[model samples]
Target: MNANHMNDIRKYLKYSILNNCNFVGHERERNQIFDLIQRTIRCGESNSALLIGPRGSGKTTLVNDVLTGFHKNKSFVSDAILVKLHGLIHTDDRLALKSATSQMNLDNAVDGKVFGSFAENLAFLLACLRTGEKHTSKSVVIILEEFDLFCAHHNQTLLYNLFDISQSAQAPICILGITCRLDVIELLEKRVKSRFSHRQFFLFPCEEDSKESPLDHTIKRIECYLSLPENSRLKINGAVRKQWNTILKALLEDKKFRSTIQRLVDVDLNERTLRNILVCFFDQL
Candidate 1:
């Protein structure tokens, strides 16, 4: 293939692999989080969970996939109020509360009104959600991205209040925190810990099978990512895809290539690492 063709493949591969959410791993975590949020939204039972994993473990993808599924449901679309707070953007409790209020569309209520302290304003917002009829209130789903940063806030009031809300059966609130920090659980105070559901999920890269010399689902993921449809942008025929598959087959069958992959597995051949390898391969092509 020429450099232009290779570049096209690389660009498409990156987006295809990235936009592909039908990953082979994390089935258990996906189901658990899905059901947790469903119960909170449907049954009006509050829930909280923390997703702890290093980068490229598909932590964000898993939540997004599950939430996307919920988004398809008519009731979920109508009843759910999603408030996403990022630690990088909202540096402290005050800013976090302000953003939350805005995301929840409460700005109009306080429009042209005096802005109260963070605690008072936050409590007022929570009270508004709580005032709805039991089992008929809008379900509030709060997702804290880079949750570890939220933990470092002074006094941890945001975490405390959110956790407190999730402990109640009347409030249909679900709090999902995504963080790479392993010690995030330790950051919570003793009082905040009591309200938390203590439901935590850990994610890691998939491992190779014990019997086969295969790379588990890694190769499958690559194939799924690179295969172009008949009407694909590249306008390449099935011949290119077949040739690519043949190349993959030869590499897997080659003893030296298998050894090289096994060595890469030592440092961890996660999705990100595999993508980097493909970039180099495309450059050489």
Candidate 2:
């Protein structure tokens, strides 16, 4: 392969492997979230949900996919205000509450002035949402990333208030908390937990082995990547692409390659590790 071919191969591998593969698991969870958002956006229903998964397991990806589709509908964009809060950025309830005013463009409601106490500010926002005024009555959708960190705050007030609102009939709010912590529920205070709807979606990366051949999805991802369309932007020579794909097929039947893949699957072939493995494959080329 020449320099151009090698570069194209690298780019194609990284893009296809890292970002292109659709979520091969969690079909139910994805659909549930999509429906939850649709109800909140269209019906003004209040809901609270938690998406629990280990880091890099695509909890964020799942939410983004659902939201991106909904964003195309004018009702979704106009009827709801989306506020994203990360535990790392808004370390406390006060910061979160302050940031939310800005996120909802209600800063103008405060006229850029330093607002009242954080609790007061939260109360004010809640009042605005329930005020029955056309502009202020938009539904609120709050997504908390790294949700466990927010639980570490002194009183867990942000979670409490959001949960309280989620159960309300007057103001429609949808709250989704994404976290890696399995015991996240235990971290919540009893009062806060009481208000939560207890709607939890759990996602775990697929275990790729039953002590068998490289699992179907495992090989399928490689097949999809290798069998790029003739007119793909990668511009890889068709004959060379066919040759590489042929090699992949032959390797699937080869004992040594199958054994190697099984060992990798035993240890979990996550996306990050898969990228490194591709780099190692490049070194051989």
Candidate 3:
């Protein structure tokens, strides 16, 4: 192949990778998140939710989409303060609360106040939430990623305080926890467990049916990607596009390729892995 051909192939690969894949096959999980967001806004009180799923199962993506939708709809949670924090970074309860308060832009207000213990930090966060409520009509949603790891802290202070604040009539704060382990909730203290109960959302791998097998799902995903029209960013001629589709069809027919993809999909059906596999095939071209 000529240098121009190779560059064009690379452009297509880049475009495919950068483009946001349309969310598919998770209607139930999506509805759960939507309901939670709606309840938090309509009730004018805080709510808590826990998202349990395996890695790359689209938990984070689903929550993000809901947040984006909430921001777009002015009549709903448009003015709501959305704060996203990873549990890996702020492992300690006090530190996480401090970071959250900073994200809320309440650092100046709590500046000079010493938070020597978990109680103090929790109090500060509550105070900040109340202040936020007074200033804006929107509620606060705090999303904690890798939630199980954060639960390993002493006394489970972070979870306790977050749930406690959500129970209050004032300072509407919502706590959304994302974790890979289903049994992580079992590790929570009795009080925290009771509070976090009845709000868990589980996302499992998509099940294969007679109409659409796992391999079929993978092919559909690839087709959606390859169907993107060539624009200024990615220029693929008619012949090259045809050749690419032919190559993908050949791969789909290959028994070993189909078996490998099926096995992976059966284990943990996630789009990120499927996209990576497609990118590897494009690299060879």
Candidate 4:
């Protein structure tokens, strides 16, 4: 390659690493999330959605990515609240309720007279928001990840309460509930089950050989490794580079090889493992 061309490629690689917001695949899911956000905001009404997926399946990341994109868009100005309830340490039900409600500092208080029913608390909070009164603004979209905990430990009181309150809300508020467990819906009360069913969109995992190829993911991971400022080059000889390409080609073409590489590298693998794989692939090539 010419000197200028090589330099340009290097510069593009560096910029890609720095920005790091490029989503290589998952176009369908990404588009679905984006469409949901846009429609909900434009309607200026209350909506709730359940995002279902297994752990490490990019459930939370997908939400964050969409929100990040929304924030970057010049025309999209909306109050998007993302809250995660994982390992919330609460001594009792009161403490748990307090911890849950306190995350937003919603100006509304749970009606003390109603004895803090999930329904009452949500009703009070929505009543206090005066949502549309804030001028021509996109209302709030609250994304709650790891929602199964509430279902597992508490009854469906809170879930149903939120559903009922959302119906009467003056300000447009939507709940984007994300959970890994498939049976999370079963835990909800029958009333909630019906309500959530009406509005929810289910997302399944991306298959290994689907448009989102595992080999491409591996290459992207390798690129990330190469871009790190570790002050230690991979020391890839000409043979090694050729070998790396061969292995990558094979991995892309063969699902078995990709699975083997995944088991070897693991999710929390380091640069050394990556280098070792490149060396081995080179020898094989």
Candidate 5:
């Protein structure tokens, strides 16, 4: 290909992979989460939230977007410290809390402290919070991914400590748990469950509007990406655009193609997956 053609291809790939994909179509859930975070920041009181959704259903993406907004705001960025933990990485309760304490960069308080015991680790976390209040007046926003894995721990000390600390700590501390399993809450211990108070947000798959089918919605999203302005660097050639239309037509008339789309939608492959599938097909074209 010529130099200009190569540049256009590069631009197209960038737009397809990064620029176009965002946390889309979760307006209600996004608003509730944003409000909770704002409330915690304003009141200087800790808040714990549970976000439940299936895999690839945009729970993590939504939370990341909210965090990005907070970071962008000058007034909130200074007072909020974002910390993320993967539950699968830290299976043990003590280890998870210790890891959080370490993230706070309170080495002076955490050093030489034996985090092997749950109480010691919990103490370290509290100390870190106290230090945060005294020094930076910052609130720690902890995002726990794979929350179901964390709930599998036997003792449930980690959940207790987190809820207790959030309630008692002077500086606000928010624990946002993201899990795929719907019944994960049933796994929490009784005391922890009561303490948590079931502050949960459920993210359902995006549904088709009254005027359109799921397939139609998917087609519309694909069309939006393909319809990027001519002035844009990302160029979609005639052949690729023709291929996309062919695929859509197949989806409408061909039994096998229709079944494939239906299966993916039934499994909760919403607009996000639609974009990914189209991008993959476009790359081949």
Candidate 6:
């Protein structure tokens, strides 16, 4: 209402926007997963890593983080290509090749008929981003989320070929494959299994880890909200803050609200029903 009060709200809003943060509950696990990917890229090991986790366990988020993080690193001069094969599920070979070529440079210089031509197309795309002059550098990581879908729907030959490309790629193509099903390897052939063995990283659910509690997570979120610049309009007085915390505790403790909470927490809940629920609960307080 007052000038000083108005100034405080504006600053808080600005801070929240600048951060654009996702307060993932499993921060420690997320960090561990990030470290493993970093080590793999640095080591230049010749193999594809599979990220196996439940659908909502942040597997895809981790993959995107690794890809975007490394690409923006100062040491990384070349481009990193992340192709979601799911998008190309029904695409023909020509369309697949076109997607690959568009993703990278498939000049006549590189053999077009190489093993797993589509995979090679991806390699060629990375190759084009090369400086041509030789120098030691981190290999270009090709992240394919839901890679197992390709194996199940299409032939397993593409994966086998990608494994081979990882071993012999000129630009050093490292495939980071993600899948929801932990038993994906059982569907793959022995050769594919052998190639993907060492690089595999399994992402566990929050319930599996003792260190990360839902309350701890909610507290962290509260901290993030509190840390917003004073000008931000998020008003959480002692009473409202306590009410918000209680709502979060209930949401996390109840499995039924897990999905709903995940969706609601990402944005401000201005819906009439949610607003009414909050009002009724606050009146009771």
Top candidate on TM-score is 1
Which of the numbered candidates is closest to the native, going by highest lDDT?
1
Better of 1 and 4 by lDDT: 1
Candidate 5 lDDT over residue span 1-285, tens digit each: 455654565457547555553465667789999988887777777899899988867788789878878877987866676778898889876677667767777767777756566755655555555532253446778888998888878778888777776776645778899998999888888878877847899886654433567665554555555543445554667665455456555556677766786787777666567667767765665
TM-score per prediction, in order, is 0.80, 0.77, 0.77, 0.61, 0.74, 0.60
lDDT rank, highest first? 1, 2, 3, 5, 4, 6
Which clashing pairs does model 1 show? none
The Cα error of candidate 6 at residue 240, in Å, is: 16
Poorest lDDT segment (10 consecutive residues) of candidate 6: 268-277
- Candidate 1 versus the native: TM-score? 0.80
Better of 3 and 6 by lDDT: 3
Candidate 1 ranges with C-alpha deviation above 4 Å: 1-11, 115-119, 126-135, 207-214, 229-257, 283-285
Off by over 4 Å in 5: 1-21, 114-120, 129-136, 207-213, 216-268
* Residue 254 lDDT, candidate 2, scale 0-100: 81
Task: Report the C-alpha lDDT of model 6 over 12-84, residue by residue, as the tens digit.
Answer: 5345433433435555556765665565456645446777777655576556655566667765544334445
Residue-wise lDDT of candidate 3 within 1-285, one digit each (tens)?
367876776776667665654555667778878887777776766788889988877787778767777777876544466777788898887678778878777788887877677767666655555534354445778899999888888888888877776775446677889999989878788988876745888886564433566567676666666554455355657777667667767866789977887787777657677677767766776
Tens digit per residue, CA lDDT, model 1, 49-149: 99998987778878888888888899997787888999999999878888888988888776675645554666567656654555367888999999999
Model 2: residues with Cα > 4 Å off, grouped in runs: 1-6, 12-21, 112-117, 126-136, 207-214, 221-258, 279-285
What lDDT would each prediction earn against the true structure? 0.77, 0.77, 0.72, 0.58, 0.72, 0.55
